[model samples]
Target: MSSLSMDKIVELQAWKLKELLKWREYLGVLVEAVKEVFNDRVEVYVFGSAVNGRLTVSSDIDIAIVLSEVPKSGLERARLVDKIWSVMENKGVPWWYPFEIHLLRREELSLLREAKFTRLL
Candidate 1:
């Protein structure tokens, strides 16, 4: 903590507070967004720095989305990933830094590692 400048500390606190206050609201927005394309077969989670309370204002939001229905082929998976990516990459997103969205299928839960994920939907 000593190494961090006062301004940086203040920035981190503000960012943490913003996330704390809006996390549920943000998750609701995420649910609505995912439901538009994914229907009820998806789960959205907040993970990484945000989940662990180490986020700075500039730290990216890390997310993991798990689809209930797994695509059968590599091409299909790629397309699914692309579709979800497009949804996440929409320009109107509110965060200061771009989010890292990990799109996976139920069978790929093993892909999540070291991330402390909190499921929102």
Candidate 2:
């Protein structure tokens, strides 16, 4: 094989992730649950150490939830959290994979560093 061809192959295969991440599939399931809370105004992101191209097998998936509109009051936020958690539990999201959740209002995003997230919306 030519050296040039090998380089091309390497470039083409760079984005490929070989692991059978059940967590990724589970994310697909959980997105629906979160959407119910915001009525289609939510976005999900895979952030933190997990998606940084340097993840160890033990790295945790840091999920960031962005809502189009934030709750107006503390009580509303609590109720929304309760509902979202209930939905997550009902979905049987396999806890086998380590993860954490970070919720953010749409406007709050302006304060976050851009390189920190990989949008899954």
Candidate 3:
């Protein structure tokens, strides 16, 4: 993963929103894949620029998944991410957009609320 500066992150967020609107159907498919992967163990949100209606043609997807339980290791998280990616690809959905997975425990509602961001999807 590449490190993104605050400004770059903000810009990317806005661009992602544009792409979401342009490809709403594909976004739905991605969301469905997330649901299938995590089941009731997590809540997936479409956050950042895409939700705020400030996206551009090059925006990437920023998805935040609040998990009921944290994975045992980073590898587990990576595997889950790969599974979601695979499902989207199998469905013939575009994978051009990047994903930002934000894992949170069920008890972290307060933290999530304190975070400054928008939920678009």
Candidate 4:
């Protein structure tokens, strides 16, 4: 069996706290970018490990962008992604940020209800 000393446990916790703080700041910038790009047309939510407090150094920020009207085709979705990326890039958000964006309609929001999430916009 293996055990961690109390000091080691505290050290690990402090590291996690620092990581969480970075993610929170990143999320704040993300929310602002979404607002600038989509205005009132979409609602954003943070889900998965980020919202559930299972955050780790390797965890990706999972976000769901609830749209008033979801794109109906693959090409449309791709264009939506491009538009968002363009706006985010213009706002100084890195294109390679460790995050995933899920585009959904209001009706589809029910599918994610089983997951822990908090509205960001």
Candidate 5:
């Protein structure tokens, strides 16, 4: 497995701490929901401003989900997204806000490139 330097890990931890303070409850629920739905098929990460410690109350959540495979149809993925969104909304966790869900395939070239970049840099 690739390893990140202590400095980078510390930076990432600090960023996550700050984000947790803002959206702890919501995120906890979201994480649980994701785990329940995707099981072992997906991995989730927080990125963008939240990952960089530059988040504001107005800043929307940026979640990156890596899946073992890209669904053959966009509708399939959209359904998953909608299910998550509905759950979040029903849980009263601030729906109708701007947020981004980035889905990536585990075997995609872009993902491979990012892994290489992280390992090399």
Candidate 6:
């Protein structure tokens, strides 16, 4: 059996949600930075545990960047991801806050919906 009781689990989950809510402002800043670079060609979404009410202690917030066109080269994609990471870091996102940035084309939005994702920006 688990060490945590049902009430304890509920409390922990609520705490996780509260912790995630605190980071939404930083996420807004990130969205603006990406928008500055991509203009209207970008849309940002927050999916996975953060949006699905299944956040675990180890869950990393998942961010999806939906664009008109995803970079074709892996190197370009890596650079873009790195730049976004830098923006988050500069905006005071702590290293301990686990998160992921994914690049996708407009066509992939349907897939995100199928996977039960939510848009943040």
Residue lDDT tens for model 1, 5-88 = 878888877966676545445565566567666766788788888788886656667778887676678787767655654564
Pairs of colliding residues, candidate 3: 14-55, 15-56, 15-59, 16-59, 17-50, 18-55, 51-120
Q: Assess each prediction's global lDDT (C-alpha) against the native.
A: 0.67, 0.68, 0.68, 0.79, 0.63, 0.77
Best by TM-score: 6
The CA lDDT at 10 in model 1 is 87
How would you encode candidate 5's per-residue C-alpha lDDT over 1-121 as one tens digit per residue?
2356877877876875565456545666676667666766676666666556666645766776777876888899898887777777776756654456666786653643433111100
Query: What is the per-residue lDDT of model 3 for residues 19-56, given as tens digits with 9 covering 90 to 100?
Result: 55665566677777788787675666665566666666
Candidate 4 regions off by >4 Å?
1-21
Q: How many backbone clashes does candidate 2 have?
A: 0
Query: Residue 79, candidate 6: how far off, in angstroms?
Result: 0.2
- What TM-score would each prediction reach against the true structure? 0.58, 0.61, 0.65, 0.73, 0.62, 0.74
TM-score leaderboard ranking: 6, 4, 3, 5, 2, 1
Candidate 6 segments whose C-alpha is farther than 4 A from its true place: 1-21
Kindly report the root-mean-square deviation of model 6 from the true structure over all alpha carbons: 4.6
TM-score, candidate number 1: 0.58
RMSD of 2: 10.1
Candidate 3 — which residues are off by over 4 angstroms? 1-23, 109-121
In model 1, pairs of residues that clash are: none
lDDT at residue 62 of model 4 (Cα atoms): 85
**Alpha carbon lDDT of residue 120, candidate 6?**
68
lDDT by residue for model 2 over 1-121, one digit each (tens)? Answer: 9999999877644523333245567776667777876675678887777666666555567877888676678787778766766777778864343556667887777655754777777
TM-score of 3: 0.65
Candidate 1 all-Cα RMSD: 5.6
**What's the CA error at residue 109 for candidate 5, in Å?**
8.8
